[model samples]
Target chain A: MSELLKNTIRFILFILVQVFILFKMPPLHRFITPYLYYLFILWLPFSLSRAGLTVVGFIFGLSLDYFSKTPGLHAAACTLIAYVRPFVIGLLISQEGADKNYISPSIVSMGWAPYATYVIVLTFLHHTWLVLLEWMSFGSFLYFLGKVIASTAVSLLLVLLTELLFFRKQKFRTNTI
Target chain B: MRNVFLFIRRHFNFLFFLVLQIVSLSFLFRYNKFHEAAFMNVSTELTGRINEKYNGIEYYFQLKRTNESLVKENIRLRQLLKENYEAPDSNRRLVMDTIRVDSARSILKYNYLEAKVVGNTTALQFNYLTIHRGFAQQVRPNMGVVGPQGIVGTVVNVSENYATVMSLLHRQYKVVVKLKNGAERGAIEWDGLSPLFVTLKDIPKSAKVAKGDTVLTSQTSSLFPANIMVGTVYDIVPDNASNFYTLKVRPATNFFNIEYVYVIDNMQFEEQKRIEDSTRKKVQ
Candidate 1:
């Protein structure tokens, strides 16, 4: 499948899973809301420009927000992470290396450790922005901290699980976008 | 003009990011405020329809529990029938009235519309529930919603086919309630902690309070009817410096498993509010 088609399918699947399954799941803990939908933004092909990435992120997040009835809460967070994803990836991977290979950031292409760090940093940023916006105030800093940490941890685990389960042995495409 | 164009070209990505961020943040703040915009919520046609469809599948799993609750409610209603009660003196004749009015039968105060819970959340600091009833069904913003067992929340936003309820578990949600025994009224608020409990504050130290004491909605509230079940006092939080005692209350409604609710409309709410506003303005 073309990369565009693949990512589009992934986007729809993510929104459906996040809204129908994850949002509807009975609360496991007060603090642990697993947000795996942003993984679509994280999995976009490397050739996409920064502006394009941000727009995609905004749309992806807005789609989730539409279903979950959170309005722009996810959109803001997703935009933040999308804008920062490139910087985080650059810090971890060399420019020439990223350009030459790696259709997208994944455990197979970026190796396990770097891919894990990429997911962790971006997920933490996303969750922090989301939780803080949802809260709209810092009445209890500890409670806020707990929510961000717990939710980020759960979301990271889900992202990693998706990585290992589906993209465990995928080969990087050599063709350009 | 050339310099400005150059600057825009140089920082197009950042500017785009900033513009999108500002738009998103504006939406977050604007709609997140208490009942400003309703189009972005789940009550909108597309999302509401999707949720209703999904609720259809999820409804089957809760059938047994829902039926039991319905049966329990029926029994409670049946027990309240006038036939079950007899006058102390058999000489007095009993009167029956289908309309819910005072002895004069002049006015009706409260009306209830039943709604199915299409979506709900208890884990978030600001939680809301989407119900299948909306403006088309006479459900409107500011109406009080109550579950089978107890008070749920108030309707905040409504579309044509659905309405969104601001759950009592939400941090911004508050209502006036009083101790059933003492009649000392205080505000009930959720502390962004557990959905099972809320905090009752500002009750004077003079009033007698104890664990397991029942709390009910007070006459001060315009949204809910008086004597509606709010919760039971669970524990007292010690605050020696203040003259008021804070009590933790376990809400009567089990928010986690709520499936159905009643939207309560106060017929005189607008009139009462208008008069109150005019009185305040006149005083000012």
Candidate 2:
């Protein structure tokens, strides 16, 4: 499948899974909500432009917001992460070595350590922005920190599990969109 | 002009990112204000329909619990039926009737419209529930909603066939409540820490309070009828600086498992509001 078709399918699947399954899951804890939909933005092909990335992130988050009844909380967070994803990736992976070759991020392409760092940093940023926006207050700073940490941990775990489960053995095929 | 065009070309991606961020933040502040604009919400037709379709599948799993709650509510209402009680004596009843008739004539102050919960969230700071009833079912904004056990929330937004309720778990949501025993009125608000408890504030130190005391909606509230169950006092939060005592309350309705609710429409709300507004206008 073309990279564009793959991402299109992934977008619809992520929204459906996030809204219909993950959101509907019984609240395991007050502080823990697993957000795996943002993984779509994280896994987009590396060739996409930064502006294109932000637009896709906005729509992705807004689609979830539309279903979850939170108007812009996710949209703001997702856009921030999408805009920052390139910088984080740039910091971890040099332009000449792997950037020219890698089609998209995966556990195999980026290796275990760099991929883990990439997911951790971006997920933490997304969760912090989302939790901060949802909170919109500094009254309960401790509670806010607790929620951010807890949610980020859960989401990071889910992201890693998804990478391991689906993309563990796949080779970096140069399929341009 | 040439330099400006070059500048735009150089930073177009950053400019686009900033614009998108600003739009999202504006939406965050604007619609997150709750009652200001209700268009970008789950109550809209498309989102509501999708939620309803999903809830249709989830409803089956909740059928047994929903049935039990409905049966319990049925028993409670049945017990309140006039036929359940017998009149004492003809002479005493005749005297009592004259005294009670005036108050009873105005008893039809609130009407209820039943609705099913299609979407609800208790984990978020600003939690909301989407119900299946809306303007089509006479469910309007500012109407109080109640579950079978106790108070749920107030309707904040409505569409043609769906409405969104600002859940009691929300940080900004508040309701005036009084101790069932002392009748000292106070406001109940969530601290955004827990879904199981809300904080009751402004009850004077002079008022007698206990951990197990029941809290009920006060007469002063325009949204909810008096005597609706708000919660039960769970703990007393001590404050040395203030004369008022803050009580932690366990809400009677289980927000985590709410399936069905009744949207309460105050029949005289508009008339009462108009009169109050006129009085304020005259005073001013």
Candidate 3:
């Protein structure tokens, strides 16, 4: 199969498993609920356009909201993460504005530190939105903090596992190369 | 101006992340009861499926126990049916029986809707179980649901063929419960730590409470019928923190080992809810 076809299929499967399968993980800790659906957005090929990423993020969120019945949560989170993707990628793979075909995110390719930090920050933001939006009560602010941290840790672990198990190592490329 | 535009082009990623964060945050800031309900529905599907997948090996080992338990339950159900037929009631007692029983089973007049477990899990702070029943099954947003063991949860969201259950283990699960004596009352809340235990919140400190007391559902709950078994009082702590007493609970249903459950249809739900809506609106 073509890379695009493979990516698209993988995207659908991850979305389904994350939203319908991982979304309902009962709070694993006092304030922590694990969400792996962001993996779909996380694994998008690096060469994707900024606008394309945002649109995919929005649709990804909306589709999950449709199944989850939570109106616009996933859409909002996905868009936010997508919008931040370029900056995150830039931080890890700086080549002085030389545009190269972006492979998908993998620790072996992005380096353990960059890939791990990328998932960490993005997953933190995603869970923060997911939990605060659902509860929205200031009375539970402490719980929300714990939830964000715990959930972000778990989500980061899952993303890294996927990278180690499913992804491959590749060297950085410059357009001239 | 040229410098500003160049700066914008160079740092666009930062701006993008901010915009996305703002959008998601705005939605979260405006969560309504519907949003909460919808989230719960999705949770049921997610958790229920995970639970099913995780428990696959354990399920095989427990088949013998489940069969034996079902046999005992059959005998006990027969006793209840016999007593129900003999007792007199002014109302027809129009609640649905979740199990399909023989003609010898008590004749009930309510409708029965069967739901399959799609996702469930217990290894979390606040546990919830989701099932595959929805508005298509005529399961509404607040109907009572049960498994073979006892009450599992109430319906929180309903779609075409999917519904979510706010399992008893959820932290926000607050239902008014009365003790075996029916005089004392408190609210039931899961501590988000153990599936085997729940905490009774907001009970009057003055109410006579003791360890080993049986807790039952109070009639005040909109979803559950009165007197459904909740748990036994495991610990009673004086909330120096608050004016109420907190009692630890042991849930009657062990959520780990079950597949099928029954969605109850309260035939009078519509009428009752209608009256409640009108009254609340009038007061407002």
TM-score of each: 0.93, 0.92, 0.74
Which whole-number lDDT from 0 to 100 does residue A157 have in model 3? 79
Error of 2 at A44 (Å): 1.1
Query: Could you give the CAPRI-style class of model 1?
Result: medium
- DockQ in order: 0.60, 0.58, 0.23
* CAPRI grade, predicted model 2: medium
Instruction: List model 1 lDDT by residue over B124-148, tens digit each.
Output: 6678888999888999899999998
Quality of model 1 by C-alpha lDDT: 0.85
Ranking by DockQ: 1, 2, 3
**Strongest candidate by DockQ:** 1
Question: Candidate 3 chain A — worst ten consecutive residues by lDDT sum?
Answer: A93-102
Candidate 2's C-alpha runs over 4 A off are: A26-29, A94-97, A174-177, B34-43, B88-90, B94-107, B281-284
Q: How close is chain B to the truth by TM-score, in each candidate?
A: 0.93, 0.91, 0.75
